[model samples]
Target: MHPALVEEFKSVDAVIASDARTAGVDAFALSLLKVERQARRFVTYLVFQYPCFGRSDVPALRKTLSDSKKVYFEGILRGFDALYPQPLEALIGAEYAHLKARVDEAELHRNKLFHGQLTEESLSRAQLLEFVVDMRRWCELLCDAGQQELGYAGFGSSSFTKSPELTMSASFRIQMQGLADYDAFIKTVLRRPQGQQAQ
Candidate 1:
C-alpha cells in the first residue's frame, strides 16, 4: 500500500468506525454524517481516476456543483454517471452486479439524511451496526477497485479490517486478477459498446 492510500484508509475508516458504539440514535445520526463524508470522497476519487482527467488540457472536475445546490452529493454522483456510463461494479467484478442498485438506495438515504428530520424515529443497535459496516465496506471496496482498475498490476489486493472493542471484527478484501479478465473489465468501465468509450 502506498503511504498516501494508507493515510486515506485510516482517515475514512476512522470516521465510519468512530460512532459504531453509540448503540442508538447517536449511532444512527453519526453513521449518516460519516457515510455522507465517505461517499463524497468516493465520488471525487472516481472522477479523478477517469482516464481523461490526467490530460494536460483538461481540468479536474469539482466535487461540488454550486453553492446553492440543495442536493450536493447526488448531483455529483449523477455527473459521474453521465461521464462513466457503466456501473462502477464493472471495475470490481460480475458478482457485484447488485452493487449499483445498492448505490442508488444509499443515494436516497443521503437525500433523507440531508433534507428530512430524524426525530421520533425507531432505530436499533443492529441497524446502527449495519450502517457502520456498509459505509466501511463501500469505502474499502472503492479503494481496492480504484487501484486494481487504474493502477499498475502486482500491487496485491487492497483490504481493511475494523474491529469494534469486543464485537466481532469485520473485514473486506479485493484481490485483483489479470489477463483473462482485463479486456472484459476495461470494456465495462469504459462503457465500450464496440470496444470504445461511448461518445
Candidate 2:
C-alpha cells in the first residue's frame, strides 16, 4: 500500500475501534467482531490500494474482505514484500511471515464468532485490548516497512508507536498526510492508559 493509504487505514481503524470500545462490557463479543471487521477491511484496502488490483480483482477482494473470508485473504496478503525497495527486502523478509501468522490467528476467531460459539466472556477486556494492540502494531510495522520501500522518510525508532495503547477517545480526529499532524495523531491514538486499558 502507498504511504498515504497506509496512514488512512490507521486513522480509520482507530476511529472504528474507538467507537466500538464505547459499548459496555455486555457487548464485548461485538467489540471483538468490530475489531475483526476492521482488520479484514484493512487487508482489503491494501489489496485494492495496490496499483495493479483494479485490473479486475478489486471487487472480489473487497467481497472477501467484507465477508472476512480467510482462504482468499491469504492471496491479498501476498506480494507485499515485492512492493518494497530492495534494501527493504532484508528488513521485511524476516517479519512478513510473522505478520501473516498474527493476522491469520486473529481472523481464525471469525469462525467461532459466526457460529455463535464464542462466548462474551471468552476473553477478558485486557486480553481483547492486547489483540487489538497487537494488530495495530502489525499495521504500523507494515506501514513503516512500506515507507522504507519508497525511501519517503528516514527511519525512526518509534514509528507508529501507538499500537501498544488500547484506549481511544471518541472525539479523536483523523490527521491526513502532513508528517507532524500524522505523528501527533499516532501519539494521541497510542497515548498510555491512565489506569486500565480501554475506556
Candidate 3:
C-alpha cells in the first residue's frame, strides 16, 4: 500500500480502538466518521502519487494542494480523471468501475452514518470494524496491482525503495516519461513513512 495511506490507516485505527474502549457505542458513529475521513485522505494520497502533469504544471498542483478547502471524493475522482486517467485504467484495467463503486458505497455509508440515520438496521461496532477491514484489503489489492502492473513496489516488500524501471510496461513508461522528476519523486514516495513503524 502507499505509505501515506498506510500511515493514515494506522493513525485512525489506533484512535478508533481507543475510543471504542472508552466510549463504547457512543464512539461508533464518530469512529466511522474518522475512518471515512482517513479513507478520503488515503484516496487523495494514492491519486497524487502518480505523475499527471508536465514540467510547467508543478506550481498549479502545489497551489491546489496548498488551498486548505476540502475536496470531496467525487471531486477528487474527477480531478484524477482530468489529469491522470490512463495510468489508473492501465493499472487496474476493467476493475476501475468496481473500485469506484466500492468507494461510492463507502461514501454513502459515511453520509448515512454522519446524518445519524443509521441505527440497528445498518450500524454497529462490528460493522464499523468490518468496514475498516474491507478498506485495508482494498488498499492491499491496489498495492498489489500497482506492484505487478506498474512495477511500483508495495510497502513491506524487500525492494520497496527501488524505483520502477524496466520492470514497468513500456507503454506505461512512455506515458509517464513526459512528467518531470517522476522517477525521483517515485523513489522518494516509495521510501516514505520511514521511521514511523506501524503498531
Candidate 4:
C-alpha cells in the first residue's frame, strides 16, 4: 500500500478505539468521507483502466469526474452501473447489491454529518464507526470484484483488511498486463454496450 494509506489505516485504528469521544466523532466522520472518496477513485480507475496504487489524487481521474459542484456518490454509482450493467454473479461470481446498499446508507449519514445535523439520537458514535468500517469493507469487496472480473493485477487489496494492530503490515504493488494490449482491451470494453463485452 502507499505510505499515505498506511498512515490512514493507523489513524483509523486509533480513532476507532480512542477514549477522546469528541475528537473521535470528528475523526470518524472524516474517515467516512475518505472511504467514500476512495470508492469513487476505484470506480474512476476501473473506468479509465488506471492503476494508482491506492492513491486518490490522480489528476486525470479528478478531471474526468470533475463537476462544478461536489460530485455525488450516486453519480459515481451511475458511471459504475454503466460500466458493469449485468448481474455481478454472471461476471465476477459475486453479488454486489450489498455494496450499493452500503454506499446509499453511508450517503444518508454523510449528508447529515456534513451539515452538522447528525445527532446522538440520529447517529451515535458506535453507529458512525460502523458506517466507516462497513464502507471500508465495501471498498475491499469492489477491489476483489475488479480483480476477479477484469484480471486486474492489484496488490493493495491487503491494505483494506481489518486488523487490531496500528501497524502498516500490508504490503502492496500495482501490476498490469501488456500495456498496449490492455489499453486496447479497455477501449473495446468501453465501445461495447453494457453487458455485451466479450469475456
Query: Root-mean-square deviation of each candidate, in angstroms?
Result: 13.3, 16.4, 10.6, 11.0
Candidate 2, residues 76-175: lDDT per residue as tens digits? Answer: 2322222222332254467656655655665565445556677445765555555555555555554555455432221232222222222221112231
- Which candidate number has the best lDDT? 4
State every prediction's TM-score relative to the real structure.
0.46, 0.41, 0.47, 0.55
* lDDT value for model 4: 0.48
The per-candidate count of clashes, in order, stands at 0, 0, 0, 1
Alpha-carbon deviation at 17 in model 3, angstroms: 3.9
Which of the two candidates, 1 or 3, achieves a greater TM-score against the reference?
A: 3
Candidate 4 residues 19-131, lDDT tens each? 68665566566666666565455444454443322344344334433522334555444444544444333442344566556656766665666677754366677766776
Q: How many backbone clashes does candidate 1 have?
A: 0
What order do you get sorting by lDDT, best first? Answer: 4, 3, 1, 2
User: How do all the candidates rank in terms of TM-score, highest first?
Assistant: 4, 3, 1, 2
Question: Considering lDDT, which of the candidate structures 1 and 4 is the better prediction for this target?
Answer: 4
Q: Write the per-residue lDDT of candidate 3 for residues 5-31, one digit (tens) a residue.
A: 465356556656676553334333343
Candidate 3's C-alpha lDDT?
0.45
Where is the poorest 10-residue window by lDDT in model 2? 162-171
